[model samples]
Target chain A: MLSPAYLAVAAALLLALGPALPAFAGRPIIAGKPAPSEAAATARWLTAQNTWGFLSTISSDLSGAPFGNVVSYSDGVPGESHGIPYFYLTTLDPTARDALEDQRTSFTLSEFPLGTCGKIDPENPTCAKLTLTGKLKLVDLQSSEADLAKSALFTKHPEMKDWPKNHHFQILKLEIENIFLIDWFGGPKPISPTEYLEYGKNQALLKLS
Target chain B: MLSPAYLAVAAALLLALGPALPAFAGRPIIAGKPAPSEAAATARWLTAQNTWGFLSTISSDLSGAPFGNVVSYSDGVPGESHGIPYFYLTTLDPTARDALEDQRTSFTLSEFPLGTCGKIDPENPTCAKLTLTGKLKLVDLQSSEADLAKSALFTKHPEMKDWPKNHHFQILKLEIENIFLIDWFGGPKPISPTEYLEYGKNQALLKLS
Candidate 1:
C-alpha cells in the first residue's frame, strides 16, 4: 500500500488539477460509471449511485397540477441494487400526500451531482439524466419487501432509520412503468422497465461490464 | 493576497480535511446562503444559485400522469436575478411538449447539489429544498422579454447559444404562483409568489442581509 504522505500528495495533485480533469474526488464515476451507450446499465447505475432524486406527483391540493419535491431514495443497499427505487416519506409532506390522492408520479436523477459530467453543462445531452414514471405505492409495512426496503434505505441514508416516530415515515416504491434517459445526443433513450430491472442479472453473463 | 504556494497549501489542507468541513470548494453557500428563517430570501437564493432543477408537468402521452425531467434554467444573468426561472426547451422533448398541452408545472431544487448541505440528509428539512408551482408559458420569440431571457440564459449557459437551430429551441418562463420552501424543520415555509419576488428589492434596507 502507498504511504499516507504519498496518498496525501496524490490527493493534493488531484485537487490542484481537479477542474482540468474529466473526473475527480467524491464523484461516482471514479468508482465506475457505465458508458453512455449502455442505456439499461447506465440507468440502473444512476439509480444505484444516487441517494436522492426529485419526486413529482399530481397535486391534490393544487387542483391536479404537477408538484415536484426533493426526496431521498434507495434502489438497494450499496452494490446489491435491484433497479426499483424505494422512498421513506411521511404524509406530512405534500409528495407523500399527493401520491395517496394520485398515485401517478415520476422521479428524476441527474449525473451532474455525481461530478462525472466534467465541464459539460447540466442541460447538455451528453450529461446523463434519467426520469422514471410510474405509480408510487406504499409497501405493506409488515411485508418482506418493506423489510428489504428499510434495510436498503437505512444503509444509504442512516439518519432515516431514526426519523421521528411521530412523523410516521412509511416506505414507498416506484412501480416503474416507463424510463426516460438522456446520456447521449440522439435523444431520450427508450428503456422499458423490464430491461432496466433485468440489467443487473444479465450483466454477469453479458459483456456490459 | 496570498501567494500561489500558500493558496495551494490552503486548498490542499481543505481537501485533506474536507470530510470534517461544513462547507468546501465549488459550493454556492461559500458566497452567501441566506439564513433559514428568511424564507423568501432562501427561496430566491436557491432559484438564483442553482443552474438546473427538476421540472414536472402533466404528461400528454402518459394520460395525465405527472412527468419530471431534469432541466437547466437561469433565473437571471448571474447576480441580476429577477426571481423568475427561464428555460431553453425544444418541442422534441417531452417536458416542453407536456407544457404546451398543460401549463401547470412545478420546478424543484435542492441544496444537496450546491454542496452546502454538508452531512445533512437531503430529506432533512434543514438542508433547504424549494418547489415552485407555476404555469409554464412559452415566451414569444418576438417579445422583448425573450431577448432579455436569452441574454440571461446565454450568460450562464454559453452552450445554449450554440444549441442546434434545427431543434427550434424556445424560451419558456415559469409564472410562479405558489412557493413551497423548506429551509428548516417545522414544515414548508409559507411564502407567496409576491413575497418571494419582493425579497431582493427589500433586502437593501432590511436586516435580512
Candidate 2:
C-alpha cells in the first residue's frame, strides 16, 4: 500500500544506519538501571577513577564568601557505602583554613564536553556540568589507627616527603555534607532536595561506593 | 672530620627513603639528577588536560554585572597540534545568546587541582589565574563536515534526546588569542604570542583522550 517513493526512502534509511552510526556518529554505553538505594553508585564510579577533583573551603570572613581552590582528592571508601562522597584532605591550605573557619563550600568534578555539547541551560537545575554543595568538616587524624593508614596515604603519593609536614595535612580528614553530583553522560538520576539536612549524626548523602 | 653522630644520622636517613615519601603527592617524579623544567613541564601538562575548563563570561546591561557560569569545553586535539583549545557550543541557551552580544567576555579554566588552586585576578597578571582575553563565535550548522567531526557529542548523552535539536551546534567554535596558561605547583613558563601556536600544538592537550 506504500508508495514507491516511500519504499525507496526506507531503503536508503536502512543503508545509512550502518555507515553513519560508528563513523560520523558516537555513543556511550551506560546501563542506567540502578537499585532504589544505589543512589551513590555514580559518585562511586567518579571517585574510583583517577579523575582530577578539587577540595574547596569556605573563607571564614564575610569578605571571602564562597571561594574555592583546586586540590587533589581521594574517595571515602567505607563512608561511600552510605551515599556521601567524602574526600580525604588537609586544613592547611588557605582554602581549607577558610573552610574550617566556615564549613560551607563547593566541591566539584565534571565529565565535561559530553555534558556541555548538549543543550545546557544554567537556569535549568539539571544543566550544570559539575555542581556540589555541602559543609566541609575536619576529621580527626590520630583518633583512629593513624600509623597503619599513614603508610597507605604515603604509598599513594610519595611526594609528601618533601612537603613541610603538619598534623593538619597529616592528621585531619574532610567530609562533604549535603552533596550534589552532576555527571554529563551516564550520570545518576537527579534528586532535588526540598530542604538541606537540619544537622544530625550523618548530615551527608550520595556517598562514594 | 665529620662527627660520628652526623654520619650515623645520614646513613639512617638514606635508608629511610623507602618509607618516607607519601603515596598521594603531586610532586612530579624527576627521573634525572637535575629537577627538570618543572614549571614549563607542569604548565604544559596542566594546560593539556584542562580543556573542559570553565569559561567565565561576564556581562552587564542596564542593571549591573550579572552572575557567572562555567562553560564546558574541549580544545585542540592530540594529533593535529593547536595551542588554543577548541570548544564546541551552541546559542540555544540564554547564556550563550547573551554572551554573543557581550564583547568583554573572558574565561578561566581551572586546571586539575593544584594543591593550592589558582584563582582569577584579571588586573594582576602575576596572579596564577588571570584574564586570558578571547572571542566567541557561533557555529554555522550548514557546514556538515565540521559537524561530522563532533558528531559523537550526542551519542554519549541519551538524556539529550529529550531536548530539541538544532543544527547550529555543529558550526560554532571559539578562537582564543593572547592566552596564558598558569600552574601554581609546577614552575610556570612564560607564555609568548608565538609559543601559543608553536609549543602546545604537538601536545595532546584536551582531556578527551
Candidate with top TM-score is 1
DockQ of each: 0.33, 0.09
Q: For each candidate, what is the lDDT?
A: 0.82, 0.39
Tell me model 1's lDDT, rounded to 2 decimals: 0.82
- Those runs of model 2 whose alpha carbons end farther than 4 Å from true positions after fitting are A1-52, A55-70, A78-80, A87-104, A110-130, A135-189, A193-208, B1-42, B45-74, B77-80, B90-209
Proportion of native contacts found in each model? Answer: 0.73, 0.02
Q: Judging by DockQ against the true structure, name the best candidate.
A: 1
Docking class of 2: incorrect
lDDT agreement of model 2 with the native: 0.39
Per-prediction TM-score, please? 0.83, 0.46
Best by lDDT: 1
Q: lDDT tens digits, residues B1-209, model 2?
A: 43445544644554466435332222232221112233333344444444344443432321222213344343334423243443444454333654577533334445323322233221111223422435556545566635543442333232333332432442334455544344333322456535554654555434223
Q: What's the DockQ of model 2?
A: 0.09
Runs of candidate 1 exceeding 4 Å displacement: A1-31, A202-209, B1-31, B202-209
Give one digit per residue, the lDDT tens place, for model 1 in B86-186. 99999988999999998999999998898878887898876889999999999999999999999989998887776767778999999999999987656
lDDT of 1 by residue, A130-173 (tens): 99999999999999999999999999998776667778899999
